[model samples]
Target: MTGKGGTGKTTVAAALALGLAAGGHRTLLVEVEGRQGIAELFGLGPLPYEERRVAGTADGGEVRALAVDPELALLEYLDMFYKLGAAGRALRKFGAIDFATTIAPGLRDVLLTGKVKEATTRTADRRRVYHAVVLDAPPTGRIGRFLNVTAETARLAKVGPIKTQSENVAALLRSPMTSVHVVTLLEEMPVQETVDAIGELNGLGIPIGKVVVNAGRPPLLTGTKVSQAELRRGLAAAGLPTDRATVSGLYAEAKAHLTRRELEESLRVELAELGQPMVELPLLPSGVDRAALDTLAAELLGTR
Candidate 1:
């Protein structure tokens, strides 16, 4: 899941993981930014580099969580390629790993994505480890540069193991199994960003997934509009228990709802033009908790 920051991409990603798990798919939820977002969402302690089962589904499928650290991934990469067991620690002591990852952000990205790709393709005793992997990737602005590691590494290393590693990572990303989903709000700037991000992802040859609309407020009056006078008259005719102040408050709410509904409709239309499957999530007035997350996960299941 990815979008402009503050679109609740992490929350959506967690919900997606839960949804997939609930469907009997053992999913691996990977967070690349080192934000511990998956941990916080699941109300657990900070997640380490090792995979741990965070939640279980109704059908007995599991959700495994991992917060990828580029440094550790680099060490693991070194050990995997070369027998750098003691030498890896020696390099860390000399700060070579730090220098390499810091000076070359692309190498860091290669390490991060390489780890994700490894998890996605990993098997035990000739059986797949994960049914699916949900990545809480970087924001829309940097996602292209982050995922397009081959292009970034080519500038750093013309031909070497690093170059070959990057090429493999890129191939995995461009493969049929990979799909990118963008989360956005029903607002002008976010919608615009989602549109632009889709275009950029298309250019990069990444398959686009659903466009998620987060935190949408439902229409107060479904499929109809009422003027203030009409609303007052209808309330009086119904003779429901209400005082003068209460009636005034209801009228004010109706007016606000009408205005918001108009704006939402306009933005919804704008999003439709992007030509991707759109899934909307309602705003949780009680804020996000376990129940809310489950509700969202169930709602997400409908998208399938």
Candidate 2:
């Protein structure tokens, strides 16, 4: 899932993973950009490079989590292809890994994406290991270039394993098996970013998935034209001794809610015009915890 940062994209990604697992798909939830978001959302410690089964679903499928560190991924790549088993440490100690990850961000992104692609295609006993792979990818701001490994590698290497690996990664991203879901809030800036990201992803030939509106507030005051006087009267009829302060506060709060709800509806209409599937996650009263994540998972999968 890719979205503007702070749009709860990571949380939605975790919920989607759980939802897929619950639906009988052995899902792998991978976190890139060095954020332990999946672990934190699952109420577990940071995940290691190796995948670990973090949560089980209702259908007996499993959700395994991994945080792909570019440095570790680089070492794993070297060990796999070059048999640099011991020299990997030497390379890290010589600050080569740091230089590559920091000084060359495109290379870092390639390494990270390469690891995710590997997990997605990895199999055991001639069968697929993960039925689905969900990546809490980089924010929408960087996701375009991050997933465009072919273009990035073309600038770095004319020919080699790295270039070839990048081409493969790009192919996977553009393939039918991969879908990029863009998450956003029902606000101006986030919705704008989500729209722009969709366009960018389309231009790059990456398959687009759902545009999820996270933390969506329901339209509580629907199907009725409520006046301020009617709101005051309704509060009074509730048998509460209404002081001037309390009534004023109540009216203000209700008005604010109605305004926000209207704005959200407008944004929702805007998103609908894009002609992509849109998912709405209601705002959780108890905030995002394990139970809330499960609730959201149910909502995401349309089980609730």
Candidate 3:
């Protein structure tokens, strides 16, 4: 439930899901956006509504992915609340569901939650199916509204099946086992967003399970008072065989790159002030895979 976007929220969710699966928990990875981000990250074809196995239990554990559609959840909600009968048929004929969902405020969030709730409790052939469900939820900013859908409806419908159902859903969201996490970068915007999100979620009684700051570079080469700029000028002195132009250019390039590194270090210092166990991931150009995810998940969960 990270309050920020582009802060590796999806990546953290995916890694956690796969890591749990690897540890032999039959895991379900649910994406609310229906965006292809999860599929693209996992190198799988885009998921359909139906639960489909994306990875085997042998290599990892049983891992399944699903993209929940709010509209379908709305239809289910309608059926549960009202026996449409003739009205349902007429609505179906004219595509009223589609139109209504499109215009209805907060309907998408309600539907999304409904779909996830359904998936979370599902059983397969009388067998306990998924042990854990990882939601690649909406960004931190929208998550409060998204999860508050049930409460919103309960307020609207003071009494009725809708209200009752909404209460039941809300109970699930507020459960102790229902943990919310945030993923962020060491940068200002993301760190600020994380702070804001935590405050909002705590106000709404959502437990902050963890705060993961991914793609953090460690202090690999440190404690050097030999400043890059000072070293640059000193190193700029030409070798016996070198000319001034070539030597100056070499130092200039090194200075620029090292300056960027120093800036990054400043950001990391700011991040340290947050007072949480920040999970630092290496700056991997290629995104997370099973191996990469394993490495990072280990770092995150303190297994490494």
Candidate 4:
């Protein structure tokens, strides 16, 4: 999942993992940014560079999380392809791993994405390790370049192990099984970024999944106008004070809410023009906790 910063893409990604993990299926949630966001969201301590079970569904399904570090991934890559096990650690001690990733950032992306590819395709005893994998990818602005690892690494290595690794990653990303979901709010800037990101991914032949609208508020007060007299009458009828100050305050708040609702409705209309499946997550006034995540998960799976 990807979106503009502050659009709650990470939360959506986590909820998606939970949703997919329902019904006796295993799901892997991968975090490429070193934020430990999944751990924080799930109320766990810092996660190591290894996959660990973070949460489980009611029906024998589970969610495992992995925070992929580019440096560690590079070390694993070297050991896997070239058997540079001890030599890889020695290079790390000499800061060669960091230097390599720093100088050629494309290699860093390759390693990170390559690891995801491995997890997605990995099988044990003739069975896939995880039934589904959700990648908490970079923001929409950088996502196209981030996922297009082949293009980025082409300049660095024309033909080598790196080229082959990048190609594998690219192929998986462009495959029919893969879909890029963009999250956004019912606001102008976020919606625009979602549009741009979808267009970029389409140009790259990447499949577009549902567009998620996060923190969406239901329209409480319908219609264009609610006069002060109406508010005063409603307040009086409800056995509350009908003072001028109280009536004016209530009217102002209602007006503002109505205005915001109109704006959100218009933005929703604009997003509908994109011609992609859409999902809206309600604004959780209590903020996101385990229960809230469950709520979002159900919403995502259309089981709510």
Poorest 10 consecutive residues of model 4 by lDDT? 217-226
**Residue pairs of candidate 1 with colliding backbone atoms:** none
**Model 1 per-residue lDDT tens digits across residues 100-170:** 88999999999999999999999988988898899999999888888899999999999988999899999
Q: Write the per-residue lDDT of candidate 3 for residues 42-129, one digit (tens) a residue.
A: 7888777777777654565877888886666666678767766677767766887778767655666667776777677779998768
Per-residue lDDT of candidate 2, residues 103-220 (tens digit): 7676788899999899889989999899889999989898899999889778877888988888899999999999999999999999999989999999999999999989887667
Off-target runs (Cα >4 Å) in candidate 2 are: none
For lDDT, the strongest prediction is 4
Summarize candidate 4's per-residue lDDT along 1-304 as a digit string, tens digits.
9999999998999999999998999999999989989988888999999999999999999999999988899988888778897788899999999999899989999999999999999999999998999999999999999999999999999998899999999999999979999999999999999999999999999899999999988767657477888888889899999999999998888878877777888889989999999999999898888789899998987999
TM-score of 4: 0.97
Q: Tell me the deviation in Å of residue 184 in model 1.
A: 1.1
Candidate 4 structure lDDT: 0.92
lDDT for residue 17 in candidate 4, whole number 0-100: 96
* Candidate 3 segments exceeding 4 Å error: 1-3, 57-60, 80-93, 124-127, 227-276
Lowest lDDT 10-residue stretch of candidate 2? 219-228
Cα lDDT for residue 54, model 2?
Answer: 88
